[model samples]
Target: MKLSKKQARLRRATKFRAKHAEKGVERLCVYKSSQHIYVQLISACGTKTLASASSIKEKNGGNVVAAKKIGTEIAKAAKAVKVTKVAFDRSGFKYHGRVKALAEAARDGGLDF
Candidate 1:
């Protein structure tokens, strides 16, 4: 079977999601598109969103700088909700470039993952 790029990425994502689901820990999920990046802190049970951040208003939301900003924003939002730990779900995106910047910024902002 030949899988498209998005389908392959989604297949990879399912493996991580399954593990996180079983553990029932809060998850910080990230998704990026050509025009924007979005993040969400999902509850342990996965039924609710605890916090969210994005780069919709940034001048160039697809860049690393914007991703880093969104990361810190999400961390601050988590702190306000009193959550310090979470599982990072990169949604099958390679952990480099913008995604890497976001994760590092989140760590710097005091999120433990």
Candidate 2:
């Protein structure tokens, strides 16, 4: 059976998540859409979200700049909750363009992922 693009991405994501789960650290999960990007800091056990940010609040959602803003905001929210380190979970998206920008900005904001 041939997998659709979305299915294939999910397969990859599931595998990656399994590996991350083994590490037992909090995760910074990213999800992107045509109009917005969302991020959440999830507990190691995956039962709760510690912090979250999204581009919906920004003036522009579909740009790299907005993603960077969301990333920085998420990092601040995480720090407020006393979380400094986390595993980056790109949700099957490649680590480039907006995704890369967000990750880099998060790092600059003192997130140790």
Candidate 3:
């Protein structure tokens, strides 16, 4: 069966999750929409999310600036929860625009990806 755009992205995302799980590293997963962006820090076992952040909380997660702030927020929250390094799972989205901005922001905020 054929998949829609979001479904295809999910399918590819499952593979990335599996790889990260195999490595037993926490993963920083990002999900973006037209008006919002979400990020989650997943445990090494892929069993739970350690932390999460999004632009929705700030009412402006759609742009690069908002993406960066959300990234920093997630990173700080992860550190508070004792998480350090993490694999970056872009959820099949290309590494540019908001996604790239968020990732860069996370890195600058002290996350190793």
lDDT of 3 by residue, 1-113 (tens): 88899899888998898777879899899999899999999889888989999888776668899999998899899889988899999999999999999999999889997
Runs in model 2 lying further than 4 Å from the true structure: none
Residue 70's lDDT within candidate 1 is 96
Query: Where is model 2 poorest over a 10-residue stretch in terms of lDDT?
Result: 53-62
Worst 10 residues of 3 by lDDT: 54-63
What's model 3's TM-score? Answer: 0.91
For model 1, residues 21-74, the per-residue Cα lDDT tens digits are: 999789999999988999999999999999999999999999999999999999
Clashing pairs in 1: none
Question: What's the lDDT for residue 109 in model 3?
Answer: 89
Against the reference, the lDDT scores of all candidates come to 0.95, 0.92, 0.90
Candidate 1: stretches off by over 4 Å: none
Measured on C-alpha atoms, candidate 3 has an lDDT of 0.90
Which is the leading candidate under TM-score? 1
lDDT of 1 at 61: 96
**Listing every candidate in turn, what is its Cα RMSD in Å to the true structure after a full C-alpha superposition?**
0.7, 0.8, 1.5
**Using Cα atoms with residue i matched to residue i, what is each candidate's TM-score against the true structure?**
0.97, 0.96, 0.91
